[model samples]
Target: MPHIKNALIRYRIIDKALGNTYNPYPSKLDLRHACEMELYGDTNGKHISDSTIEKDLFAMRQEMDAPIKYSKAHKGYYYDNPDFTINEKPLSEDDLTSIQFALSTLSQFKETEMFQNFGFALNKIIDRVNVDSDARKSDADIDQMIQFEKSTAAKGNEFLQPLLSAIQHQYIAYFMYESFVTQVKKQRKVTPLLLKEYNNRWYLICFDSVKEKVITYALDRISDLEIIEQVGEKPSDFKADLFFRHSIGITASAEARPEKIIFSAGNIAAKYINSQPFHESQKIVLDTLEHTKFELFALISEELIRELLSYGGDIIVQEPNSLKDELVKRIKQMKTNYNI
Candidate 1:
């Protein structure tokens, strides 16, 4: 049985050689040599013999209408059939949905126009996936299907080169930044470490030289930026991935450190949290019969508060009096608004 299986696999390899040909398929002995080389590389200087390959070819001739015929010059068999074609069947419904979701996600990058080719390639995949005769739409309709609009007219192309240069060289770029909080006008010089785009907004993760600490400045708030020759050094152990792993958005400040948070979650909320972790430091504390207790280690920024509020009654922050106080205040304000 094993020998027959190996022979079948070898025949499949021969079919592959034929499918890849422009005119005539490779000779039988040549095909076997190619397959042997591919299947078993020069691990111990061992290779399949020519006679064994010829016997395999002879055995294949008795099985099916293999387009192969004998050739004297090549001293082996060659393809005689000219009408051979490899037809790629259409993808399943699951494949189409998966392709659509991928294309939708890719549409987010069209803001920079760098991923336009991906959009085109996604269209081809969508066309192949959707084979229903009555289907009217094509994957090219992704442009209309997805609406990834950036709040600010982000000039990803015009500013990307200079910004990347500033980040890589650690040079300071002068930007006219308008603070959304205080609406303050400040000309600041910062040592760039990373650039992050979140929720359709671009942010620069850098150490403010004057402040001597890390700060996140929104790119949309930047008016005019020019890279300066002056450069500064980042922390020796500073890793962007680790730094932002516990953060939500770019609100993590220099003073922000990992803090332990205990919370109770409903079954639905627990599943949601498990699907996408609240923080890298998050862990399931108690998985009981009714509810779940979760411990989170993350930067307790305004983003965290907002996320908790969005979940409403589904989650309850157990410890950290500061967070509890804030949540209570917000809840009280909500109560006062409704006067209930």
Candidate 2:
């Protein structure tokens, strides 16, 4: 297909010709030069004639809404307006840096509608930056980091889209799921409540109507998701945070109410809980120089235990003797199997 919109062409021109210095509003000569470079690329001695360049520039200025400006000093042209701009709320240097960081992180989402939406917002902000000097400190490394996230976001979207559709349409979604306990290829009918992206992979938080409860189905294990037209209403007052609040994963059923469970963490595990709180009700119960006890108000699930076990000897469940006994029983079963 013909490159009619020419986003790449426009982007390259802005990068090379303007070099962040030329006001997005620029003179005639600059436009001419940019157009030539964009169309032909470093033709050495063979350049577009000045008259043809002027004609092209005039046509572009008349037809397109590109920001172009004329400068008397250099006797050339520049962008009259930025391609896009953003009007952001008043921010400190740190705030601006944080926003820039967020934008960079969010850039990974560029190809998706979400990224494009944010880009539109960012463009308006960039246009409003009245910095006269084009030579802002070069940060290629930071740009690279931003670019990497954008690429990762594109790949992540492959799983997110369908789950999103299922949640929106209120369709019963059928997926081939691997049972975490049984390790069996089981087909399930679920009312997809929300799509959650924790760590890296996408997870479908859904009400398993057949199982008569909610469950978290890993997107990786899901295959052949056919949305059934027969719709069921999501439970009234169904808040995702409340549903998954106490549980570590999607294993918590309505059969269990919220409970406060205390766990002890030594060394790095304590540090982890301090920085990344488990839930809203997480609090430091006991603190010593070597160890810390945390009270987490959440429904204790098998997933929560697995997360605790993954911490090895660093974390110990201090409360809920039922859960502790279950862990102990598992340990004994393992020992018996090993004849130890």
TM-score per candidate, chains pooled: 0.56, 0.51
Per-residue alpha-carbon lDDT of candidate 2 for residues 17-97, written as tens digits (9 for 90 to 100):
543341334454555556665567643426555665555545445544345566677675566554432122233344345
RMSD of each: 18.2, 15.9
Q: Give the TM-score of candidate 1.
A: 0.56
Could you give candidate 1's per-residue lDDT for residues 1-340 as a string of tens digits? Answer: 4355455556656655665433244765557666685567432325566675666667656655566677687565565765542223233343345546655666677556676645765555455444331243554554454444325545432345567778778888776678888998788777788888776677788887777788888776776676798777576767887778778756775556767889998988889988887676788989987789999888788888898888899999988888999999999999999998
Provide the lDDT at 17 for model 2. Answer: 51
Each candidate's clash count: 0, 30
Q: Which stretches of candidate 1 lie over 4 Å from their true place?
A: 1-158, 233-237
lDDT of 1: 0.68
Worst 10 residues of 2 by lDDT: 127-136
Worst 10 residues of 1 by lDDT: 85-94
